[model samples]
Target: MNRILVIGGTGTVGRQVVSRLAATGARVRAMARNPGAARLPPQVEVVRGDLTLPETLDGCLDGIDAVFLVWTAPATAVAPALERITKHARRIVFLSAPLKTPHPLFQQPNPLRAMVEHIERLIETSGLQWTFLRPGMFAANALNWWAPQIRAGDVMRWPYLAAPTTPIDERDIAAVAVRALYEDGHDGAGYVLTGPQSLGQFEQVSAIGRVIGRSLRIEEISPDEAQRELLRIGPLVAVNMLLNAWAAAIGQPAHVTSTVAAITGAPAKTFLDWATDNAAEFRA
Candidate 1:
C-alpha cells in the first residue's frame, strides 16, 4: 500500500480527497492544525501539523510516498514545507491558485504569488515528480455562499448574477488530484480544470432551484451592497479576496478549460449535475 499525506485535509476539497482515498483502500494520512476536528475516516491517520512549521512534519513523513499539498495561509512557509516533503516523498500534487494571471493578486508584490512561485521553482528542480492542479471557482462555493438564502426562501440575491464561470466540482478536482498523486502520467504537468460549461451565477442558482423542485428568483445587487452584506456574514479576509477576484472578472469571461475531462476520462460535471448530487445540502 502506498502512503500519501494530504495537507489541508479538513477543507472542502481535502475532505473529498481523504474520503475517496480511504474508500479505495489507500494508506492515507490527513495533516491539519486541528486533526481531532477533521472527522476523517478511521482508516486515515490524522496528524497535527502546520504549514508554517515544516519541522513538525518529520515524524509524519515516515514512509510517505506522495503528497497532496494545499495552502491554507499566506504560504510564506511553503518552501520549507516542500523541502521537508522532498526529502521523503517521490511525487507531489499541489493545489494551485489562479494567481497564474498577471494581475496584482498574482504579481511579484503579492505574498501568495511569491509563495506559489517559490514552491513551483523548488519542485521543478527537486528531481521529484510534480503535478499542479489549478481549478477555477468551485461549485461548492455556491453552497457556502448561497445555500443559507436558498434554504430560507426561493429568492437568491447576489452580485454578479450575470457573471459567468466554469464552476468545477470540488469532488472532480480531488479525483484528478488523486490520479496525479498515485499515477505515472501527470509528471511535470499543470492542469487548469473547469466545469463542462460556463454558467452565470443566476443560472447556477436556477439549476439548484430546479434540482430541489422550486423556482428561485435571482435579484442582482450592486457590488457595494454585496460587499457590505458579505462582510457582515462571511469571513472578512476571504470575502474581501473574493470581492477583488470578482471585480477583476467584471467583463472578462472566466477561463474554461478541457483539462479536467482530458485528465479524468470524463466530461467535467455540469452545475446541474453537481446540484443534483448535493441536493440534500440545499433542502429547505
Candidate 2:
C-alpha cells in the first residue's frame, strides 16, 4: 500500500519514471502545474501543484512513502518544498546535473544548482534516506537541437564538432530514479550516469543518420555562431550555459561512467540505439 509522489511528472524523465512505477502496481501520484494536460496513465493520480508554492502540496504528500523530486523552481523555494516532503515521506530521489569544474557553474548562485545542492544538504541532516542521480547530457537534447534540421533535410549545423559527450538516454536515468525511490541501499548515494560511448557532435548527428536512413550532413559552425542561433531560438540563460559547457568540453575529457549499468544490472544504451528507438520523432 506504499504510494510515491512524483514532482515535475509531466516532463521527459518524470513521465518515464511515473510509467515504470505505475507498472509495478505502486500507487503513483503525479504533481504538475496543469493536471489536465498531463498525459499520464489512468492509474496515476495527476494532481495540480507548483513547486514555487509549497503550500499547495499539502494533501499531495499524505501517505506517500517516497518522493521523486525534480528541481523545477528557483532556489528560494527549495527548502520549503523539501520540508513539506520531509513531513510525510521517508525517502527522496533527486535529479541533478554533475557539478561543473574550474568555476563550477553549479556553484555560481544559479537557482537550479543552488536549490539542488541545498536540498541535498537538507536531506543529509533531515534524517531522510536519499539518492541523487547526476546524469550527463541527455540524448533527447539532440532532439531539441538536431531533430528539426533532420526533418528539414540533409544538414545539421552545430558547435563543438570535436567536443564529445556520453549522452545518456533519459529512460535509463528514469530507470535508476525509479529503483532508488522504491528500493533500499541507495540512500545517501550520488550516481554519475552516462551513456555507453563518448561521441562528438558530428558523430551524434551521423548516428541519427544511420537510424533514420538519411545521409545527414554536419555543418561545423563556431561556438559564437551556435550561441547566436540558440539565442534566437530560446532564452538567454540556457544558451549561455550550453555554450560555456561546450567550450569547456572541447579540451576536457568526456565523462563516461558505469554507474547506470552498475545500478541497473544492464549496460547503458548507446546513442545509435537511442536514435533508432526514437526515429519516429526525427522523421519529417
Candidate 3:
C-alpha cells in the first residue's frame, strides 16, 4: 500500500500507529474530528472525518489503499461507515477484542462485544482484505484506573485485586498494526495479542509505584464501592462489563500470548516495562 489512512488518529493506540508509520517514511494520513487540533506528526496529513457521519469519510478515504480503523462510534453507524470505507480502501486493520478466545474473561456477553461482532461480520462479507488485532487488557488502562489515586496519595483502593490480565502495551499493538497495514501475508489474519506475562491488578499498581519510586499501599474494597467510584470516570455499561469480567477472572491465570513478539520480532513488553516508560503519568 503506497498511501494509508488512520481513523481515530487522536486516540492512544491510533496516535502510536500514526507516529510509527510516519517515522518509517510511509505516506500516512490521520482522521480526526478536529484536524487543526490533531497534533500528530507534522509530516502526515490530518483530515476531518467522523465515523458517525458517513459523509465525512469520503474525503478522508480518497485515494487511500488501506486503513487502520479504531472504531468507537455507535452501532447504528457500523454499516454506513463500512460502506464508505469499502468504496475506496481495499484493506483495513481493525482494532478488535478477542471474541473467539476460549478464556472466560472475554467470553462474557456485553454491548461492546456484540457491536464488535456485528462489525466483523459486515467486514468479512464486504469483499475487502481485513486483519483483526484482538488485544487483551491494555497497559494504558492503568493510567485511567489508578493514575489519579496514585498521583494524590500512597494508597490505591480497588476490587478484584486477585483477578489477572495480560496487559499489552499500546506501542506493541501499534507496531503490529503498522505491519498489517503495509506488509503482505497478513490479510484474513486474526491476531490475539497480549503481554508476555500475567499480572493482577494489585501487582500492576505496585509496579507503577516501583517505577515512580513510591511504596504505595493497595487497599481492597467491595465491588459495589468500586463500581460507584469507577462510574465517575466511565459509563455504566463499560464499568459493569469490567466488574463482571474481573470477577469472572478470579482464581484463573490470564491468557498470555507471544503473538506480539512473533509479529514484531521483539520481545513483548512486560507490565513493569510499561510502568517504567509511563512512570511520569503516575507522579504528582
lDDT of 3 at 93: 97
Clashes counted in candidate 3 amount to: 0
Runs of candidate 2 exceeding 4 Å displacement: 100-112
C-alpha lDDT score of every prediction, in listed order: 0.82, 0.83, 0.94
Clashes of 2: 0
Question: What's the TM for model 1?
Answer: 0.88
Comparing 1 and 3 by lDDT, which wins? 3
Q: Score candidate 3 by lDDT.
A: 0.94
Off by over 4 Å in 1: 101-114, 232-237, 250-253
Give me the candidate number with maximum lDDT.
Answer: 3
> What total of clashing residue pairs does each candidate reach?
0, 0, 0
lDDT of 2: 0.83
Q: Which digits, one per residue and each the tens of the lDDT, describe model 2 over residues 1-284?
A: 67899998898899999999899898999999999889999999999888889889878888899899877677788788888988989988888878642323222344455656777789888878888888888998887888888898898888778777889998999999988987789988888888988788778888888888888778888877887887754677777777666666775557788888888898999998899999998999
What are the models' TM-scores? Answer: 0.88, 0.92, 0.99
How far in Å is the alpha carbon of 11 misplaced in model 2?
Answer: 0.7
- TM-score: model 3 vs. ground truth: 0.99
lDDT of 1 by residue, 1-284 (tens): 78999988999999999999999999999998887788888999999888788889877787899989887665667678778999999988989865565433222234445667777788889888899888878999877788989899987888877667789999889999988988889998888788888777778898899899999888998878887887755666556666666656656566777887777798888898899999989898
